[model samples]
Target chain A: MGQPKQERAVQTRSALVRAAAEVFDEYGYAGAGINRILKRAGLTAGALYFHFGSKEGLAEAVMNAGQDTVEPLLESRGLQRLVDVTLVWAHRLGVDPLLRAGVELSLGHEDFADGAPFESRRELMAGYLREARDLGELREGVDPEVVARFVVGACTGIQLYSRQVDGRASLPQRVKEMWDCLLPGIAAPGTAQDFDTGVARGERLGRMGAQA
Target chain B: MGQPKQERAVQTRSALVRAAAEVFDEYGYAGAGINRILKRAGLTAGALYFHFGSKEGLAEAVMNAGQDTVEPLLESRGLQRLVDVTLVWAHRLGVDPLLRAGVELSLGHEDFADGAPFESRRELMAGYLREARDLGELREGVDPEVVARFVVGACTGIQLYSRQVDGRASLPQRVKEMWDCLLPGIAAPGTAQDFDTGVARGERLGRMGAQA
Candidate 1:
């Protein structure tokens, strides 16, 4: 018996997203071609149009899909949770084509300026840093807003460097190093020892994500 | 009397580099075209071929040109010098087209992986941090190599964020903020007060560059 139509449609949509992601990852947004994406997906142009409507639509789908990975970490809080978020996201950025493409598009494409999550990510980080401050995990005089922006920028630079240096294979390790250098500046005295800045921390989260 | 052949050739080469920088800045490396670059420069194909040989060759010229802006910072030393380097470069990256294009090309072009200055920039930063370590300007436990890599990544991230969020008009200010957040982490307790993280520190350097 054939798969149900709804189930088959869902599969097709996912397959198209994956294929588009690979193309975007390799060629970037301006260079990516719809024909190439369709060929990779082994789907008709009609299917792509029916699902994503346009190449821009498909690109937006890939960008949005990258955010779905964040759902699993919502249970955690404070500075350690912030570290977990960066670590897990770095690990996924190394392994996931959709996330990688989303980052490339978000960072480099001027037309998609509003779509980039620099503001939202900074706000999320600020929220976590606020929690850390309330819990007395942060050092005195450290502003959550300021520190949040710095962390966002630092994580971005680390990933960009790792990506260029070794295709992001070292992102988690670099992020670990970043936290090591930064934690002492932001965390309260004696509290710096409480947070784990290990690559395994991210790997464990990845495993948890898979199990769920 | 006409200009010397050498002087004319030099002018042609610099003009071509500037025009190419503008094109690459807007369209990126892959999206950039030789014809468009030639049009922007108002030069024929033969002139481009004579000067830079190929598009890739021209890109190398642009990348190398970005390093020219660093020459002025070499006379300073230790932690303050390291801060100066980032601040000055951030200021340049905000206003200079050649430097801006060089960074854009260096960060995003996969084929140019070996060409990106990730390792070299990190090494240069390490060298400065080593000077800081020798001068006892760093915190006792802070490793220069680790801190160097982190600083490079953080500066890169700060510049990238500044570029995306506001076209880098605020880069020097952001760099100062970065040093404000980071100095406590790396510098010795009494030494963080010695370094200047002001935007004026960079603007003064920019003015000196112009005068020179």
Candidate 2:
């Protein structure tokens, strides 16, 4: 009975964090009221306080949760992996209502006195770039750290613009364009030709499959 | 006397808008109260209301004002200009207490019934891409609209990341990387070689000038 109660408490905390993420994304941190968060979670002030000491604490938890979700996606992919994961995640994180809540949490920490959660993501990207270089995927004379930051920066730009605008540009198309522009610079000299050829072949195969 | 009063009123309205922009950026839209904006502008409700009918009205004015400021810069430089101007504008927009406030007002309008103000900026970029295509600056088989959106998207990403984190990657460096990646894909074939040569010559000329 006690174990079930503890599990329920954990579930409640998770629900609260998730609710808080949505509210924060929609209304921003300073604009979001604790009462609203508690109300949405269907919990009392005590439960809220127990899980997160204050609003700032809640904001941090939301960000931590988001980082937990995205960090692993970053680690598993190669350079191409980053593009694939981002395209999948962008739909969820950049477009889907539930996941889009994480965007607010990430942007809201701009006012934090300590440091923002994005720092960890940036470091993770830089580390991945270093690994990619060691694996000889990156071009000669390319600074892995610089390229990492650039890649991350480009992804950030796609998400921000996609979220703000109406039905002007599709997210997937935007991602493809960014990747196309970006690959030529960081790619080992002839690698771009190979990738382009593969993309063309893949399109042809897909077309033939669709016809059949 | 009436003309001078109108002029003074214009100046006062401008001052109030500037002050509101600062407050909105720092505290965000919902968090920023009309009283705070008035206090910052050294004015009262009557004065503010005289210029702008309501808080929403004031936000519109701020967005319109920002568009006026930003459009000319874009027009003069063309869409392909490097991130220098964009970065300068972003740093100002992010850090300036006044401009930051305006940014929040602009961003918060996502929920507004009408629409956000920066919509035209996207159109402007798309138009620039079309013009670039006619001029043979863009590569064959590339979608100019997609490329334009991609460039803008990349810029937004760099701005958001640079502002959120403290790191060795300066805004300019990140912008440069984005351009370096983008130009190769979009530039006319062999244009990358021309760019590299131009950069080399520019550096040599600078060194010779310094020695002389």
Candidate 3:
């Protein structure tokens, strides 16, 4: 329990989460064996037990960390900010193991330590949609909470399909097309015309986010 | 083969497919055991191999059959028919084990027979959208293929979320909400005004499709 020992335990826990995320991302929860996770972390059984009681515990820890890693970027306002958040998240999915694995785990239909692994993503996006509504950025008929749920489902599905199809090489375009297909219905007339849905927008935003 | 033997083989194959679908649906591809599939079918290894070469082969057969079970619901015209197709399919996802198992396999992120399990569904929806475009049923500036892909992704993700959160009992409403959010952007002006996206529509159409 000394300061140095405590620091080392924290580092060890982080490593375990990262390694578990990789294995889960690649092989899924059912396929990700505890033996493989231990081997990947280079930790002994005693050490793993001290940190996480079981595979389910490890998965929950990873999900919590991944959700934190995906905290919304920038302090910008309006519906464009919502679009930016989604696009940047998509770009990050291909590059960030924690996130990619977190998403994989979320879709597995399991209950994580933090209620549902994806509940935060849904709530956060819903908050943004509510803001957009308050600002008159949304179309007259659109319901912010309902539209927010659509966004969550759409992004989740897009990423799942992209991963299954091609390791997400086409995610940027798919994200853009998703917006292109959706904005016309929900955005205030003519306001979404200038918003960037291109791959480049996400790449740039993601890069900025990492530095920030 | 003799005529009676061929008929028996056909019966055995149908039985195997049904049993495999149930196993695969409940346990996923990786978790589905060959022993369990055989036990469920009440068949020997020789009988299984005679129809499907291996577990992979069996999964492929299940996926192909699932896709077929999901054939477009109505031959009606316009975007409303597109809406009907989506709604009917959502209702079926809960009631049909084959479709459910096939979807589980497709989302398993593996290579099954024919190609990726979801490719044909996307292509078929895209084909429908193209026809809608040619018939002037699409809104100006909307791209049919792009919308089709969104539809596929949205539906896939919604079904997944619904399954995890509520055993897919909420699928009909989710599908309805999905269309409510997307149609304003894609449907022809004044055309989507009266389309029914309620669960009742799906239930009614699904019953009709079954009777037909």
Candidate 4:
């Protein structure tokens, strides 16, 4: 196919995923209708099937796309920073149907046999925790896996709660407060004080690890 | 009209709720069929409707029942202890269909009506945070509402993650670790150490203005 044709195909697929996310967020996985998704995407059923094999396939694609957007924020900043960033991202993204859809998609996967399609998201978070631990940001004898789980759990809780409360509290500020409470217990005794100095100085700790 | 008839009606309704929870947990809110629930409860369709009115009504009943079980735990322990106890309760409950149903019901509400259903849960948590602050368990200047949100968020996150990981980690140990991290940020300076010491002395802090 020529470049123009390829570009159009890619655009159509992207639009479908975006539309699918909105429908899924509003109606959930079971309630979401494939016909509605196709209509919203400005495509027909045949075209959607051509791009994604079935409704489940489309849901998975939408989930995968959201993870792509969220995973990097977790990786680059490390888990702690990821928590902070996600709160800000959630607040900024709140009320936008697409982001809301992404959150619902992520949460709804809890019971899947392959175990939450956001498996990559968990792995990425685990990796950041390992990195954080190796750098001595985590306390001596603290289990990185355990801490990682806690961090992930806390973030999930914050996102859900913030989305529920919406205007009453700032999501970003709530995220920071959570991190502050959590860091002191998990951080090597002295590192907890670093955040007290401010976020910029705290960011430097990620680079100045024991290996550095 | 007789006492026996009233008793039988109550029993039948309870059986239907229990059966509905199991079906809902297995198939999700939208996926669970009323017929299946009726079959499992060994009741006719008329009986089910007489009890719950509709599928949404049935879901609300399931939620109300779970909340009834959960409310006392919240009232007695306040927030921090509630997290600790819930992990224990989940472990004790094991893979019981009822607990699984409760989790599914919660996930189903993810997209429902923005956020009203969660308000009671949020309020119970906030009440604990206020109590903690009054007892000098939390920092003097921290907002009780904000701290409560974080605690709730962390708990929600941990429950979802732990349920996913299943045998990979001990839920109670994970809960302790979360508390370890979170307590420091919220506790009044040096109060955590005192609180830790006080626990051994059996000097529990009285409940804060929790009802508010």
The stretch of ten residues in a row with the least summed lDDT in candidate 2 chain A is A197-206
Interface RMSD values, listed in order for every candidate: 1.7, 3.0, 2.7, 2.4
Assess each prediction's global lDDT (C-alpha) against the native. Answer: 0.83, 0.61, 0.79, 0.63
lDDT tens digits, residues B2-73, model 2?
Answer: 568878898999998888787777677777799999999999999888889998888777766664243343
Q: Over the stretch A25-129, how does candidate 1's per-residue lDDT look in tens digits?
A: 988887888899999999999999999899988988988777736545447779989988998888778677888888887787766666257878899889999
State the lDDT of candidate 1 residue by residue for B1-212, as single tens digits: 99999999999999999999999988888889999999999999999999989998999898877774555535789898888888888877767888889888788776566625878888888988999999989887888988888888788887788777887887888888888788877788756668888998887886666566
> 1 or 3: which has the higher DockQ?
1
- Chain A TM-scores, all candidates? 0.91, 0.78, 0.89, 0.75
Let me know the DockQ for model 2. 0.43
Recovered fraction of real interface contacts per model: 0.59, 0.63, 0.59, 0.72
Question: For each candidate, what's the DockQ?
Answer: 0.61, 0.43, 0.53, 0.49
C-alpha-based local distance difference test score of model 4? 0.63
Q: What C-alpha lDDT does candidate 3 achieve relative to the native structure?
A: 0.79
Residue A165 displacement in candidate 4 (angstroms): 3.9
lDDT of 4 by residue, B62-120 (tens): 76666434334334443355443444444433444665576556654654535554566
Error of model 1, residue A84, in angstroms: 0.7
Q: Model 3: per-residue lDDT, tens digit, B1-212?
A: 55798799899998899999999878777778889999999999898898898888888788777854424547665577678788888988878898888887777645652235557777878877888888888889887778877788888887777776678888899898898888778888767666778899888888776676
Deviation from native of the Cα of residue B48 in model 2, angstroms: 2.1
Identify the superior model by DockQ, candidate 2 or candidate 4: 4
For candidate 1, the clash count comes to: 0
Error of 2 at A183 (Å): 1.7
